[model samples]
Target chain A: MSFTVEKTIKTCRGKLLKLSHNSAALNCKMVLNVYIPKQFYENASVAKNKIPSIFYLSGLTCTPENCTEKGFIQIQADKYGFAVIYPDTSPRNVTFPKDCKIDPNDWALGEGAGFYLDSDTLENFQMGTYISEELPQSLASSTDLFEDKIDFLKKRSIMGHSMGGMGALNFYLNSFERNSNGYVSCSAFSPVVNPTAVSWGQNAFKLYFKDYEHEGKKLDPTLILKNKDFSDKNLNILISSGDADPFLENQLKPQNLIDVVTKKNIKGIRVNIEPGYDHSYFFVSTFIPEHCEFHAKKLGLINHLIK
Target chain B: MSFTVEKTIKTCRGKLLKLSHNSAALNCKMVLNVYIPKQFYENASVAKNKIPSIFYLSGLTCTPENCTEKGFIQIQADKYGFAVIYPDTSPRNVTFPKDCKIDPNDWALGEGAGFYLDSDTLENFQMGTYISEELPQSLASSTDLFEDKIDFLKKRSIMGHSMGGMGALNFYLNSFERNSNGYVSCSAFSPVVNPTAVSWGQNAFKLYFKDYEHEGKKLDPTLILKNKDFSDKNLNILISSGDADPFLENQLKPQNLIDVVTKKNIKGIRVNIEPGYDHSYFFVSTFIPEHCEFHAKKLGLINHLIK
Candidate 1:
């Protein structure tokens, strides 16, 4: 995919830089914001230290800019001294059916719904490869700002909001656990747990995969947990859901994963059901710090200063 | 004025009930989002304890919803056991000439430019009374949510971003010298320090006040500091501005206040010029916790829980 490196600003500590990159990753040229912590900037000798990093996936139809724009993850990342990578969900080049619908109810399926899965049925959607594999490799190999900053080997975690939460879980279960350095932990907010059952998920899944029942299992954490034997890896899983979330009953049923984990005795899964929180960033921002701290501890980088 | 009350769910918290009231004072219907700390719901009597509170004022054209929607203050508020009150800017009943213009250059004067001052020329724009006096009274008298729960007389600090920063500073200066019940420190993000000098301020001043220069002094901290004797107040002031802020040279000239405070040897004022930061919330969120801690210390609230 063709891309353009736009601008880079060196933060106060001089150890981190906020770089904005415009890329034609999926199809439409997208703006991706990457926060490269101070470590890579200061020590060019240790550039290839292969520090573990995390990709913060955002919800449906959200450009990489939303997380950078509204989400305050950069502060926490600075504190944790980790690189934060953000990528857009879907390329805007391709148009889907009913793309212009304004109803919030239809928001989950159309524009924002990349589902973070590889599309087997459609030609345009290859986001699954773009994010999990291609994006990481590009960042690692390119001489751009993120080259030495992203350490995919040491330790890593995956987290997101709404549809991004589903992406985090799907990526963690399907690929990150097997490929990356080590799985520290994964957390999500108001996530769609059983994608095969919900309408939002059904629509996106049908568009992405051919055989719904079989292929959907690979993307559904609830289904994957029933058969995948990841308990031996000591993965620390934290899921936060607001009971008052408008999509809770219909789309984001955290209970689905709880039931699976309970039945299988999943070792390191903790679900926090927040009583009054909804599906907005307010809910995600509340618990995001805990997730960062969770990953920092396992990565053994909690006390490590950015310099 | 008519009003509506909407209950919202906060992640891991009990409930967030918003009071939407139309304020005849400001000629605008305002909404305040109140997050009743989990402690309040867990213990019914805690509601009567007169807990410490913080008032978050948003910038031009923004309602109480902006901070709640994207700012992520509630999460920290919940963790710190403090009640957060978000009051809208000006009333919607009155629309100025600069409302809803698409040009970025017109950002300071138009739809988003309430300036947080009482308009002497425009009868409808008495927003100063709304924020400083009427709003607090309404919070205490009309709502059970804040009446017994908030010690308006005890621990309190005001904060805001952009135009809201100007409001927070104005409110603090007016309220702090009197040794108001909850006179804690105050902070601002990319605040408009000299509203009289910039185009945004000039346009807003002409619309709001008959004597632009003299009335402009009421909103500008630099102008207020010349006549006001804050030497004895022991008020804490934290002002953060980005070196790269697009408005730095024109509208939000924070250096104006810094120069005054430095020359006068202002004891309690602390100015943080964060390098590489801009006019975005990312800049604000980075140092917001420091401002919270600053207020928490003076308010005698527990800061241990935050870390």
Candidate 2:
């Protein structure tokens, strides 16, 4: 449960901490970045309030540093008095069974592509358990940085980009409405919405799971979103994808989810197709402010403004 | 003067255009990036008024991409209705005479270390003419992006980091009093102020000029600032250096400029020693908002704000 603080970078109105900790869930060392906002450094009243946290999971081939350096969410987090956690997309430096081991060059499998779901058989590729259940508990008690002043476990929102977008949606759909410990809100940027229906998810599922039908079906947001009780009214599901994203047709078919919402009339679900925007950090950064504001509203960070 | 656009990325409140063009000044192809703000898309009146341009020169070994990606200037440029221009640090894909040529491995004297000044011997290293003079003209006339709508030449301010900071100070000090087209204001981040007193400058001067002492002394901001007439109340010089910058003592002596200003009672110049900051874009991006505000005031981008 202990963590190692790697580097503390002073960014806008906050410090970006690079931390590495041994993960019991994945049976490997995990690296992640946390941005503690200026509110944490303020007086006793702010600390007593116990700030909420937002987890931003990055896409494929991304380390914890990519989004931490480029996403530019720290500014909005500072403005809203919330902390931001950037977790590594997949487990690294772990052993895999011969049946479960994937090709090193395959981007959709092996190292960086964890799919944010626990595999049917593999022990090392248990990203879902690490991020969903274990990471929150470990981070809350890991360092003096939080020290109970930041609520990493209870009041948190989830957001991601591309592969991580798939992770956020799947994680949210899998866990949302089940308990209060689930994410308060969920959003994605150019996410892989229909994973079981897409090639990336198909290949990953085939590689990671022996019983793909049984296990993969449970983590599919396209199916889970259709089944979720959207009548709750507080179920804020925000999704966005670039019209110019190269993977729009084959890989990321956000239109499927939009159609589901249109046909089902899912109340709290919103999907936006940004024009002339590509699937890059540039696109993510552009919409990050809006997403942060959305999460801030849902997480009660802007409760004062609402009052 | 034709430009080949490599990538057009949609960033927050603007579009980041990565462009490469042939530079007649340096007799080599040069790459640059421009961020056109949302103000350009609003209406014809806004276009008629013309948006100002801010030139950001990078330090050693930096491509036009580095600062464009990391400096975080697009936010401010969009906020103030200005276009940001990021020019490459030096000439690339050019040959040099044996005596004038530097080792490819040497970072301080080769392709990435143009020093923003014309070499005394080499024709290819004519960065001074390219950035200060030719760049503005080319950008104004080259493409339909500007098309007599964006003010690249007439209304502009200059800013830089490290060696580029030295370039900003020297270029401003050299041209401000003599010409109407000169930059309206100048600023720097962790700049190498007294180049003549530092080894990087000494080495670069020796390689760039045959008569190193006479020619190199003119490029030194410390000497130029001490010698320039500060009686003009309109002249604004903003400079900042990180206290934790590794080269603070030997190379980036920003304190020397501060001492010169203090002793001489220079009214318009301000130097800030930022605590816990470093000689990195992380440091530059932190204070870039203030720099943009400063330039926005001088360039009349926010004249309405001044009562």
Clashes of each: 15, 0
Number of clashes found in candidate 2 = 0
After aligning candidate 1 to the native by TM-score, how far in Å is the CA of B103 from where it should be? 11
Model 1 stretches with alpha carbons more than 4 Å out:
A1-3, A7-25, A41-49, A69-71, A95-105, A176-184, A228-236, A303-307, B1-3, B12-15, B38-49, B75-81, B95-106, B153-155, B176-182, B302-307
Give lDDT tens digits, candidate 2, residues A163-264. 999899877776755563788899999999988899998888887788887777777777776766666655788988989899998999988888878887
**Reference contacts preserved by each model:** 0.40, 0.58
Please report the candidate that would top TM-score against the real structure.
2
C-alpha RMSD for every candidate: 4.2, 2.3
Fill in the DockQ of model 1.
0.38
Clashing pairs in 2: none
Q: What value of lDDT does candidate 2 attain over all alpha carbons?
A: 0.85
lDDT of 2 at B107: 87
